[model samples]
Target: MDIIKKRRSVREYLDKPVEDEKIEQIVEAARLAPSSCNSQCWRFVVTKGDIKEQIIKKGLGGIVLANRWAKSAPAIIVACADLNFLTHKVGAGIKGIEYHLLDIGIAVEHLILRATELGLGTCWIGWFNEREVRKILKIPRSIKIVALITLGYPKGELELHEKQRLDLKKILFWNKYGNCEG
Candidate 1:
């Protein structure tokens, strides 16, 4: 809970390089996350130095100007998902549910929590030029790009932004929707 409370979408980052070991540990957490029907489709591309610059230039330009802040991050993780799994495809057709997306969301949370535990800062970036990213990263057309995560040490002391959430009374129910009492 403390780690959950400490987690924030950090945009500013230190210039120092993140240790590879720490990055591995964070991804390990995601690797262990539960996926729909065990269809573990998540793939990650970790970029740094020159490649990171190329990605920032080619993939984050134009309308995604707000994400320019990610340039300060020492590492950018490109989260991808292989949509070749039959279960997710069949589930989507039958139930109109993209289970792979749910799987990716759960996996990303695990990654963020682990980064928080390691005293590293992270931001989940959903806005970007997917086609540009695919071209720059050499990602095949078959895979779906889920999101990008900027990772690095926070610059100076970490100041958490206040998160406003709905109260349990408003969001929770005994069993049915809007039913508070059993």
Candidate 2:
């Protein structure tokens, strides 16, 4: 199986810390991710130690209880997009498409996949108070927070079961929606 297929969204993590070199690899994957029109507007804020704790306990605000499991993770990577890029401005103006968010999403997937390949656990977090996170990270208001990914080692024996997904026949159509053979 491909590493991408093996990747799972892990919530529980061991208290062990991720090595700096591994972190570098994960960030490098994000850096190399393809961006729409090569906008490369994604920005990542890596939180460790005390800052990591603060992000979980405070930055997440009332949603903390829902994602409390991630608080134990040794590192939390916050993904953001710098909307100041010319492609973002032009695309949004001309086509009403937000390419920066797409770029950030692709970059985050790369980071998470790299972490998983390196034997690290990761959980992608999107529900939270963006304002609070931006304030805590000291990010400028012009930037848009995209997502958060927590990283660490697995807490126990890891196993992979068959993933539940829609059948290809049910989701795929030859030419358009409802065009599949009946």
Candidate 3:
């Protein structure tokens, strides 16, 4: 609960690089996440230095100008899904469900929470040129780029602001869709 409360979508970051050990620890957290049918389809690519600059320049150009702030981050983690998992394709065809995406989401959340515990900050970047990222990172055509996350030590002192959220009574239902009480 303390880690959950500390987590925030940090945009600004210090110029210092994130330690490789910390990165490995966060990825280990993701690796332990449960996936649909035990199909661990998620893969991660960590980028820094010149490669990170290329990603920021060529990949995140044009309409995704809002994410330009990611350049300040010392590391960027690219999450990809390997489409070779049979469960994902079969589930999509049978039930119209993209199970790989759900799996990736869960894994990424695990990574983010662990990162928070390590005093690292993260921001999920969904708006970017997938083609450019694939080309820049040399990711194969068979892999699907899920999302990019900027990571580093946050700039300045941590803020004391409370996270705004909808009340559980408004979102949680008893048994039926609209029932608020059991």
Candidate 4:
């Protein structure tokens, strides 16, 4: 819970480099996330230095706000999933496709939590141009890019903002969807 509360979408980063061993540990955590039918179709592309810069540029080409923060991150982990491997085993159906995406999401969350525990910061980036990113990374067509994660040591403390959320009383119901005060 400490790691969950401390984790934030950190955009600013220090110039220091993250250790290779720490990166490996973070990846290991992601590898251990539960996958549907234990297919484990996810693959990670770890980028640093010049490669990281190129990916950031290509991925953020259309998003102005994201480009600013992504440029500062010391490393970027692009999560991709082999679509064929995940769905083929399940046969032809939409359920298999859904499982692949769900599995990727779970894996990425595990990565973020592990990074937080290691005193590192990460931001889940979803607004990137996926087609451009695939070209930049030379990712084959067989895989679907799930997300691009930016990682580094935070430049400063995270400031909490007062964001609106649905109250439990309004959202929770005894058994059905519209009933409140159950």
The deviation in Å at residue 144 for candidate 3 is 0.5
Best by TM-score: 3
Q: lDDT tens digits, residues 12-106, model 4? A: 89998899899999999999999887889889999998888778777787654545578888999999989877354564375445787888999
Q: C-alpha displacement of 105 in model 1, angstroms?
A: 0.8
**Which residue pairs clash within candidate 2?**
none
Per-residue lDDT tens digits for candidate 1, residues 137-157, read 899988999999999999865
Summing lDDT over every window of 10 consecutive residues in candidate 4, give the lowest-scoring window: 86-95
List runs of model 3 lying over 4 Å from the truth: 158-161, 180-182
The number of clashing residue pairs in each candidate reads 0, 0, 0, 0
Candidate 2, residues 1-182, lDDT tens digits: the string is 56667678888888899999999999999999999888789888989998888788877768556887787889999999987888788898999988898899889999988887898989888887777787788999889988989999978644555678988788878776774465
Candidate 1 Cα RMSD after full superposition onto the native fold (Å): 2.0
Ranking by TM-score: 3, 1, 2, 4
Q: For each candidate, give its TM-score against the true structure.
A: 0.94, 0.92, 0.95, 0.87
Give Cα distance to truth, residue 86, candidate 4, Å: 5.4
Worst 10 residues of 3 by lDDT: 173-182
- Give the lDDT of residue 137 in candidate 4: 88
Q: Give the Å shift of residue 166 in candidate 2.
A: 1.3
Please state the error at residue 144 of candidate 4 in Å.
0.6
Clashes of 2: 0
lDDT for model 1, on a 0 to 1 scale? 0.91
